[model samples]
Target: MDKSLNTEQVSVEPQEKRAAKPVDRPFLAMLGMLIGGFVGMLSETSLNIALPSLIAELHVSIGTMQWLVTGYMLVIGIVLPMSSLLQRIFSTRSLILFALCDFIVGAVISAVAPNFAILLIGRMIQGIATGLILPLMFTVATLIFPPYKLGAAMGMIGLVIMFAPAVGPTLAGMILGLLSWHWIFWLFIPFLVVAFILAAKFLPNVGDISKPKIDWLSIILSAIGFGGLVAGVNLASDSGWGSPAVIGTLVVSLLVLAWYIRRQLASKTPILNFRVFKKSQFTTGSILVMLDFAIILSSMYLLPMFWQNGLAIPVALTGIVMLPGGIVNAIVSAVAGRFSDTISTKLLTTLGFGITIVGLILLLLASSTSPMWYVILAHIVIMMGVPLAMSPAQTFGLGALDQQTSGDGSTIMNTFQQIIGAMATAIATSLLAFGSSAAGNVSHRIAFTNGVHVGLWFTLIVAIAALLLSLTIKGQKWA
Candidate 1:
């Protein structure tokens, strides 16, 4: 975006020395991306707060209103697999500016829509924008920054990812308390508009852009594979996992995904490159990322319900209580990023998962008699551990790639993160339902707490797996 450095070219090689240009404006580009990412993550979590209000105002049943969230996720899942292809077709500046504007348009449309159909359409459009921009943010940062500084820059991006959801519900609750549900969409416009303006003037091209031919077969398979997989998992939380819809969708999705994987491996120009997995650090790091995200997402899903039901905490108060943990998460994500460059990331990841295990133990030990501070402390500890492990894992994975496949690597990581998040939440939901059902003759609150413990135990096991994987990293540097 900064035309002043037109003659200066930055190499894709992380270790390659730059022929240092004085006028390059990479931070401005990153700032715009950070803003765009914040808006996207905020859009993700904030809307749940407004769902009940929107249902009442729109005269829709509870099930229909949830489509606003589920459909948004579905569309995003479909689009994410095509991100590398999209990057090849559009320049960084052009692509990001378009996504920012698209987000703004969707926000405006959702804010003014008078019916459920239009609102759903608007939310889906916003979904597409996020699917395009999120991977690009990672890809751009990977290509632009040198390896030495890249860790801190990735940590800053991690802040946007972790902090937005942390505060989004609180912000939305406060907003809805005073204004109409429409204000939620209205607020997104300003943030995204600022992102668009900054990106237009400063975002520079990173990778070589080639207008590759669209592979329609790959696109269709991916949509059905990813979209169906996400949809099935999402529905499982409400519809029992045994429900025909869930079972059928999951079966069809897995089969299609198998076919899709085979096609990608054989294709010369695959829409989603599966080849990135050949790099062991990238594969190992990605598994760590998925495991960490699942732990975080499942805990986040279960903890609020645990508080509200078992401890009799109010819904609003639960968000307030969670605020401290979010703050700690933001700080740790930033610090961990900088530390990754100087420390052994494998050690950092091992430490992070270790801390997470302690937090989970604290949480499992607490019950109806546990003090509120204990609950908050447990959350804060997990928050610290997750991003501490997550950021470095992310850095380690992307650092393994050459510039040619950075977009593919980023897209692959992002797409898996989403599916893992959904699956974790759904699995937690099922465990709670089953565990509570088995808590024979107990009080409702006690029964639910029993279910919560079961879920926490599952996450604890995953955290241990991640810890073991971190050890296998052997302190090896990727590049």
Candidate 2:
């Protein structure tokens, strides 16, 4: 056996030993993590609704102001692949505290920001917190919860993850209705404080602290590689694929990522283990999870635009129309988690994709004259499909790993999610632009509706691919 593999196994033994014995107050620990995770995720999409308001208040162009969202996502993607390394280095309790502190401080900075630069800085800081909290929540859940209960636990975690983005626009819409844009940051303050308190009180020191040799080269490579890749893809929608900036960045990103992968494979003590892919189940699950996230994000991106821009619904009303679907998504996510514990993920995921395809077809059929009720029903159906597929697929994927590799598995899963989200959004945007351009001289509403349909069709193709993949999932449950 390889010496580094031996060392890795030895390092995990202590963690497993600790986890084998039940800790006091597991539920509180989970709650603390969930609260922090929820608040962090909520902050991600919440700002979307507030962007227009911010544009007017800050006197910035939409292109420049988008960095608040883009930069935040970019920072999260850069930091996510480092999570397993951090997990191995820091105790769970210490890491949780650091993440919460980062989040709270960032929120303060954002709330008081007098300019876009400072606001962008604050958002990046908060992104660091989100990147840490999400994977940590999954890793900690696997460590603390017994296998029998993991589905439900991860399901609840899914609820927070999926639900937060779902409700973000609605919440932001509500906040902006009554308060200024700054208050959006302020709204998170109370939630962050509560989460911080809970975490300080209940989050446990679950993982073993093995101070492995830090690989600066790997760190640098990942920062440039993943960062460059996501940035390139994001810029494609605006810069066009053939633009030198886009092409150059992408070329550099690909070369650096290739080098990074080579280095990881050669290093006995790789910062992020690629060996996790040696498990076929993990790979399948990871792909499925990525597809599911892409579907969710792409739909989320298209629908609101379709409602507000195509149908001429007000921003606040668009949010209100989508609220029921978000609520249903949360409920289904929780239930699906419990069901995965008793049922086959293959069945659940297939059914999910089928329902989602139906919803997408409905969405594609929608016209400018479509009733509000029809749109609402279509959104609800698609939203329902996401949780049905997401929670089980996630639980099944991460659960396949041994306790030792859970951190690495979780990190890989989440890192891909962020990357996929950025790419999907970019692709969806490009398609929309293409579709609009093709509809020459049409009314703006009609042009935008055409774009929306094109995007939905693209999403449908991906969902069909995911459904087919889900059918091929062989294991009935986690091995």
Candidate 3:
């Protein structure tokens, strides 16, 4: 079906044509979005520590269980490009309420899931909610808060974005220790209910709803293109890269994505505006952001496995190990947002990548016998760099855009994050498998460490590339 409404269905009042009043209660509205977003992001990494448990209990391979992470991100990648169109078609309040409901339903399905397939279905459902809520959080912030206050609002959002992932492992670790993994799903229900009530009671309709013709072909292409690409990468770890399933899907995904980009460039009301790339700073910022997410996700995915499986650390201890770094990441992200006001994006991003590289190098030193303290320190260092780079790079990129296209800019940025994250996690998993297999006679612990080192080396290279790209990020004055 066409995703747009018929003319008769769209009642556009003159008042609707005017801009919305900055929200009547910005804090309440922001609070609801933040809480919902925290739940969504917490779900993202919560499974990292639980992967080993799920694999054994569900009789799945590591590659198969990783889907709990990869599948969630893949769904988000597909849904994010459509968020701008969704925002135009629905009021902010209506959308947030629906997303919350969607999440609650998904959580229920996940908590009671009987099999791996059923659990995955539930995760994807939750991903759909996340895809809607994440972009809307920013879109509503821009709509309700004036420019001066925008920085602080975004910093708060960044705090949730960074902190949630940071804390997810620890939280999941703690929960699994005391209760079943099912409680992880149940634990968030109360918070989700609170967020839903707050949103229903307080969220203002912040944006005008307009009837934009949806591109059915674009939607299909996006779904197949991104889904096929991520699926192909994910399967590569199981089937070799040259396997027909892998090569065929990757080739098809690339061609479809090319066609999709061309269609977007030619359309007047594209679902995701490709024109935003015409801005040099936005382009550079987009690349840095994508690489930054890839690095963060890859590390997050690999580290827990390394600790739990490779080093034989208990799940709870592994989570405790990462706790300090998560806290550090959250604090640094907030401070980095403030620093962006006084610092150049170039300087901040450069330093961020530089620190990330050091963190990766330290991670490379981890082996079966390495001290736990060293691993913790390395995680903390890498976590510090991400916020230092991410907050400013994101701000500068979207800041470079005119107010008219900032929503599109946010969609593109968030879309790439999930897409790249899916790819990164897939590739890291593949590397882990490949490295482990190549180790031949080594013990599984050493073999896994071998794979982790390979993955870390690859992430280190991406960070260096991001560092180089950060150097090219010209000031906004030039834009």
All candidates' TM-scores? Answer: 0.88, 0.92, 0.94
Query: What does candidate 3's lDDT look like per residue over 1-479, in tens digits?
Result: 34355554465535433333555678887788899999998998999999999999999998889889999989998999899998889887888999999999999999999999999999999999999998888777766766656666677877888788888999999998888899899988899999999999999887778979888999999999988888999988788788999999999999999999999999999999989999988888888889988898888999999998789999888888989999999899878877777777888889999999999999998898999999999999999998788878888788777667888998899998889988999999999888888888988899989989988888999999999988787543321
Better candidate number, 2 or 3, judged by TM-score: 3
What tens digits encode model 1's per-residue C-alpha lDDT throughout 1-479?
Answer: 56545534443433364412212766786889899988987776676656546767889754456567667767777888888888788777787888899899999999999899999999999988888888888888877776577788788877777667656666666676577778889999988988988887888777577889888888999999988887887777567788999999999999999999999999998888899999998999889988987887677757766877788775567667877888898889879888888877788899999999999999999898789999999999998898889888988898898777877998999888766765776677678777777899999889988989998998999999999999899656533
Ranked by TM-score, top first? 3, 2, 1
Which predicted model would earn the best TM-score?
3
Candidate 1, poorest ten consecutive residues by summed lDDT: 14-23
Candidate 2: where is the Cα deviation over 4 Å? 1-21, 55-64, 477-479
RMSD in angstroms, all models? 5.0, 6.2, 7.6
Global CA lDDT computed for model 3: 0.87
Ranking by lDDT: 3, 2, 1
Q: Residue 106 of candidate 3: its Cα lDDT?
A: 93
Instruction: Evaluate residue 63 in candidate 1 and report its C-alpha lDDT on the 0 to 100 scale.
Output: 44
Error of 1 at 428 (Å): 2.6
**Tens digit per residue, CA lDDT, model 2, 1-479:** 69999898877745433544366877798787788888877776777767656778899864456567667878888899998889879888888889988998999999999999999999999999989988998888888877777888888988988888778888877766677778888988888888888989878788888989999999999999998987887777677788899999999999999999899989988887888988888899899999998898778867777877789887778778889998998889879899888889898999999999999999999998899999999999998998899888898888779888888899889988887876776677678777877888989889989998998888999999999999899947532
Best by lDDT: 3
